[model samples]
Target: MVHGYSGKILWVNLSNGEVKKQSLDMELAYNFLGGEGIASNILFKEVGPETDPLGPENILIFMTGAFVGTNIPCGIKTTVVSKSPLTGIYGESIFSAPLGLDLKYSGYDGLVVKGRAENPAYIWIHNDQVEVKSAKHLWGMDTFETVDAVREELHDKSISVVAIGPAGERLVKIASIISDDSRAAGRCGLGAVMGSKNLKAIACKGTGKIAVSNPERLDELRREALNIALPNTKTLREHGTAAGLIVFEQNGNLPIRNWTRGSFPEAENITGSTMTQKILVGPNPCKTCPIACGRRVRVPSGPYAMEGSGPEYETMAALGSLCYNSNLESIAKANDICNRLGIDTISTGQTIAFAMECYEKGILQDTGGVDLTWGNPDAIVKMCELIGMKQGLGAILGEGVRRASQLIGKGSEKYAIHVKGLEFPEHNPRKFKSMAVAYATSNVGANHNRGSPMLVERNLLSPELPWKEPVDGFLTKDKGRMAKVYQDLCCAVDSLGMCKFMVFWGKLPLKILTEYYGAVTGRALTFEEFMRIGERIWNIQRAFNNRMGITRKDDTLPERFLKESVNEGPAKGQIVELDVMLEEYYRERGLDEDGKPNEGKLRELGLGWVADIIHKK
Candidate 1:
């Protein structure tokens, strides 16, 4: 029996409504380390470059990590991997929701959904009993309503619901999947893929306890981690992810007016501090989480009165500073709409910000029926609804910044502010030089979760990493190496079915991470060995993208960051020196000048099959 994982894979064929329980391949677990790692490997093999993301060909795999149901703190995250409808390449989204926890307890490490339902459907998993049921009645419901409806229909309040809303049902490229009405798998347009498959929701309820190796050691390690991690994460716990709004504004890291401005003077007005003072109800922690960085908020009463999950830093920057809107309550309302509509707030906000810029430049004569003036809270909130509902102009913007720009061109592409098809989240690559490399080279495009060398460059991460010395944030020196380690380590962390917060923000050492793994699965990997697993997963994703025709040219930042320098604030007169870093990054990552992992590199990572596919024999 596997100690940590359930050793079972739930295979669902939505086309035929066939559900099969297969034994997990342990060898893959050793190489991939579960969660996104295993899923990425499987997706690479099962899904090809020709696969249509919103068609029946694409398979959505939800894989939890080894430490999910174990004693590891903050190890409750799950990864959803599929071909992207938005980026047209590698797609993955991570979320820490009860739905994932329920998945582990239901005796499956992974759930693979393929094919398309003839009608609206939802997967119901109750321990060993799995069924695909009609979701016709729940089809038009919002995510919040869908969750409640599923639980009511199932007659089990404890069941976890991962559902989509109108945005996803309409196949909006920026659609997100909301879990339990709070957390979201908020990237890559995977929700549209779900909509394509007619999968309305997945309600899960579990009753089994997970078995862990060296339970005593796991408990002790958990205690030690709690002691160390809790202290480091105090600020995060107190303020939520938006605490850096003012700080980022001060440092020129906040995106303002579609990334044209260097700073947001009113950043403090709509920050996590302001939210805490105004709307924050309390902490909303996930299973096995101690930091509780997730916030529960509510607008007491007003036009923007209502909420469940609050906006994090990305949403705040995307909907707040990027649109030049500083009304915290209105931002909260926008966040609520996005959450319920199952839309990616980052992309939605960026698209609207782009429209706002386009409106200013006369590229767009009208923005639907709304006046998209800068800093207009009403316009920002209205755009959120329009985009989510895909109403009028929202229909085009919901295609995402990349496609939307192409459809409405005239120097609008310059302000599209995206790498590949994915829009920039909140982070400013110009402010944090390392982020330039990280964002450009991400498999899913403009990604922050896959890796964030900026954290290290900002000295926010612990010194457990070998290159823990102080870094010159502006210099392009060693940033390549930093991005390499950052990306690889992030793969390892994501695959562990763990949230990076406690480890990254909690300042926990890498050794502790290894200890948690060892305690859970009796696999005591050294830091080097652990990183090797990450490197392997990273290689597979890169290889998959390579097979999808991604080359060195595709691995690039938006032209704005390369050509346009911010003329004011802390990052004043600064543009990302990406070429110098990319060359070094490519070398460090063992990729050729074309940015594809060399055959030698692939084979060396035990991915000879990947080499065979991506590299002509």
Candidate 2:
């Protein structure tokens, strides 16, 4: 039984319905920390290289950090770790709380699901008890309906659920796992992996309490952490992340017309200010998050009139400027569909935009006479449905940009903008060189969550902040250090279960984090040790992907990004000079010829336990 403000990790093998509980590994916990860090270590040992991403042999881990269920500011994030069907590498997705807190109350610090169910099923966890209940009745239902029905059947309105919709059930490579209504484990096709196991959802409820190692110190540190996070919260509430849209537009980093152009024709029509004045209902926040960047909105007279969660900057750009659709109503609708269907809004929007460009270029005939054109809200909504339902052209597009372009070849691959099979977010690399490097070396392909250096380049690099500004976004040399520093810091923040947004608003430093960790675990450590743990976790994740056949060659941008220049904006006539960035990045990362992790660096970081892990064939 779990005691002392902690929960047990339950390992369930669906193949035989064998359930067992392992006492939380204190050694691993003290060394690697929790959430993504612990999950990374577990995946490295349990998942083999030959395990197909979509196969039953793969392991799916649902993990929460030590800080989760605490009152720590922005401490609500949970990590979902699995092998990605989209990138074929280490797949990690973060979602906010209410879910994490519920899972903790359910008496589990983490849940490891291995093997596959013989038939469709869902898992129900109530405190110490676990059940592998058949979900045949819930099969084929959309994500929202399934959650509602499960909650109703359990007769618990407050039970937290993480589930997939038709998109996952159909095995779309970019399908997402939706949680807490709007939050998602959005990238890396974790939803597809869940579907492959014939699993639908996991509903959890527990009446247990999470204990802090030092409650008095933890309370004191949480108070200090809030002081650190207040500034971040204010900025987010005022401008939202969409505030950067203006900056991006000014710098010519806004992707317009499928990236053929750098500036949008109707940027002002759908910017943050416009959204705030027109339809912004209120702010939405994750559990324990002080920065309420999430928006709740309702459009009174547009195609999307239903009240629901509003789009973030990525969602706005993917469905808005990238496709040249300035209709706020349509963008709102697309956000709703993406959330309800459990798809990555960024990739989904980008994929549909690529299809539209292909249709415009006569590379693909419109299926069922659907038109693929710029600035058409109707087509955008229709395509979203088709993608979710896996109908017609949606089938081809749902395979992700890499495979989608491969299937519909004719130099179409040139325009399928992505890296290592994953699609890019809304940011334009031409305007931000650091952004370019971040996308190039991200473990899970082109995701920004890995470490977005653009925040440093644009927000903090001015004369006022501690950092010095380099050249404009188009420059490419000396970027390796930028990405490396941020990646380490990001790993630390993620391990601590803190949101990256807090870095911008609050002066969250290593000291603050040390205090937080010290307060929670009662295990005091120097700042250097905390940072080393972050690096260790990062290298372990890199090693996991390295074993999965990912190499330096896989760390590359799409052909269009390397070859084509943006046609308009201040960043006009520029392409990502990735070669210089890649070389410097590898050097800074201590990698040898083939982008493998340097053995010496691993040893230096006290990761000698698995030196051979880095050099695996």
Candidate 3:
């Protein structure tokens, strides 16, 4: 018996309105583990090179980790995988929400939605039953309204719903899938894929409890996790992710004015400490999470007035520093618009910043008489609404910075900060050299969450990394080794359905994770064996991209990061030595000159099939 999983996969074909259930292969489960690992494996096998990201041929997969629906701490993350409309490659986003747990309880290990619906529709899952319901009325609703309306119609307020808003409805490439109104699977434009499939939402409810192999041991691990997480995450709990803004700004880690500036003087105005002093209501915790890094905030009697999830560090950096808008309330308001409209805040803000730069350079004309000048909070908010609704100039911007720049090409691509067609997140690779490697090699493109070695580069994570010496944040030396280890570790944690924040607070040990897996699945997994699973998953994702024509040349930073140096702040005069990092990274990753994973590495990781695919390419 498989102790951790439901041992069933729910496959929904939107084209024919058919629902099928298949038992999960135990051997596959053992190899891929769960969450992103399982999703990546499925995508690699099903989605091919010719598959259009937004076409009916593409498939969207949602998989929970083995620990999901169990008592494991911070095990509420769900992996959403597909060929991204934004990146045009293998794309995966991990989000924390109760939806994953509910899906697990619905007697399925994962949900795979394939093909396109004939009309607007939604998938409803109640244990042992599935329904493809017409979503005609819910078609035009925002994310918040969609969730409310779905819950109201179902007469189950507790039902977990993952829905896209108007941005998704309009097929915005930066669209996001919002779970429970606030939590977002925000990267790679998976929501656009949902939109292409005519899927409005997926609502799930389940009463069944997951069975564990060793309940007592699982309980013990949960207790220990709490103990480790509680004390270590006080700052996070109190300040949320915004706490790092001032520090990041000081260190030149913040991307200001669309990656042109390394620091923002107005950063303190939007810092977490300021947010707490101004509009903070409380901390919002995810299901089974102890850190409670999510912020609940209310802006009193302003245009941005209302209660909702506050901006985290990424949102703050993207909307605040990246655009040079330090108005905290305005940033929150923009965040609210993104949340409700079902758009990725990072991408939305980065696109707006890109447009602003274009406007400054006379490449893009003012749209509808709204001047998109830098530091204009009103213009930023207006653009958010426009992009969300896909109205006016927003229509062009909705396609994402990559396509938008191409449409308005007059050296516009030079100012467009992106990797693999996906816009850059708020982190600047110039500040953290290891991030250069991470941004370049990420399957989803320019995403910080894929493998953030910033912590290791700063010597933050402890019991020490496997490197010979402490890593320096500014240097490229041994960065490839540092990034490789961190990426593998991050992949393992995400597959296990554990939140990355837990790594900071809990300093979570490999032994603890292995023990938890054994306790839940009744399968003894060694640390070495588990780490190998992460490596295998990473290789599989790379293989998926390789099949789509991603080569060593594609594994590169934007020209801005490679050629431009920071003109101000602590990281002033710093330019990412991407060529230096890429060579070392390719070598350490066992990739050939063209960045294709070699046969030896694939065979070593039990991925000879992947090797075969790459070799043919």
Candidate 4:
């Protein structure tokens, strides 16, 4: 018997509407752990280099980790992995919700979806029973409407629903999958992959309880976690993630005016403190979370008046400061639209900012009658809606900045501000030099969460990590070492279905994680063994990307970030020394000059198969 796991994987082939149960491979589970780690290994074997990202060939895997549903703090994350429609490489997104827990209780550790349906459909899983129901009438509904419709159709309000909206239905490259109306697996365009399969939503209802090895020990850990997290996350609980706006602006880390400026003077008007005063309704916490960092907000009577999930720092920076728009209400409204319409706010807002820069420079002339100007909140909201609906210029912008700039080229790629077809998040790498290495070396391009070394560069964690010494944010030396350690930790956290926020709260020590894992799974794993699993997962993902032709050249930041310097604020005259750090990073990671894992490293990590694949390629 397997502890802390259902030991079952649900395989659904849409083409023939066949559902089968595959028993979990204990050896693979032991080596890779679960969630993104196991999912990436599956993708590496099944999805070949020739597979088209948006075609029927690409497999989408939704997986839960061993710690999920065990009352572990911040253990509610679900990992969604697939070949990316946006980046055309290994893509993964994580969402915090009850969906993955419900799946685990329904007697499955993960769901592997393949092939295309004949028409629109939705998957329903209730305990041991699975059904593919026709969703013909729900095809065009937004994410909010679809969630309501699916729950109503199933006659179960308690059921969890993960659905897409018009953006995904239209196959926009930046589309997102929304869970419970507000929470989203917001990156990588996995929703477009669902759209390609004619999948509308996944609804799950399970009554079974998860099995844990030592309930008493688990209870002790739970109490310890709460004791550690509650006091440490006071600021986050009070102000939500938007509290960082002022700090980011002061530190010159916030992306302002399409990354041209280092700071936004109007930042205080739309900060987390301001949001609490103007729009905050209540705290919205995910399953089994103690911090409760999510904010539920509303805009009362205005052009942008609407009620929905409040804008986080990424959204606020993307739609607010990136375009120089200080209208907090408008940013909240844009957040609501992106959530309902199933689009990634970061990519959508960044794409609009890129277009605004082009329009200002006379490179982009026509915007289908909409004003393409900076600092215009109305135009920003309108453009977001159009992109969601795939209307007019929205259709062009919906493909993301990389493709849109390629289509409308007049030296516009330089201003596109993307790496490997994925737009950068709200943070500027020039201010935090380690962020430059993090963004460049990430398997998924330009992502902040993949492994943000800013946590260390800012010295947020106390007792300082033993692997690297603390350094100034502007310094480039030793950043590669910092990035590698953080990346491995992030991979382990993600694979274990734990929230990254736990790092800040000082609740994610390797000892506590191993204790929790031992109590949950009944297996005694050492800290080194657990960390090795994380390293193995990272290498496998890198190998998967290597098979797709990603090399040392592809591991790079945008030219604008490397060539240009920030002209204002604390980071004035600062530019990212990516090459100096990249070489050090490759050396630290045990990769060759071309960024491919060497034979010795692969053999050491027990990833010999990955080495074989890379050699054949």
Report lDDT per candidate. Answer: 0.89, 0.81, 0.88, 0.88
Per-residue CA lDDT of model 4 for 104-147, tens digit only, reads 99998899999999999999999999999999999999999999
TM-score of 3: 0.98
Clashing pairs in 1: none
lDDT of 1 by residue, 265-347 (tens): 78889888888998899998876787898899989898999968888899999998999998999999999999999999999
In terms of lDDT, model 2 sits at: 0.81
Assess every candidate by TM-score: 0.99, 0.95, 0.98, 0.98
Question: Candidate 1, which ten residues in sequence have the lowest lDDT sum?
Answer: 461-470
Deviation of model 2 at 491, angstroms? 1.6
Ranking by lDDT: 1, 3, 4, 2
Per-residue alpha-carbon lDDT of model 2 for 78-127, expressed as tens digits?
A: 89999999888899898884667777877777888888899989989888
Candidate 2, which segments miss by more than 4 Å at Cα? 1-7, 461-472, 614-617
Candidate 3: regions farther than 4 A off: 467-470
State which candidate has the highest lDDT: 1
- Residue 173 lDDT, candidate 2, scale 0-100: 89
Q: Native-vs-model 3 lDDT?
A: 0.88
lDDT of 3 by residue, 15-93 (tens): 9988999898888888988989989989998999889989999999999889898888888899999999898898988
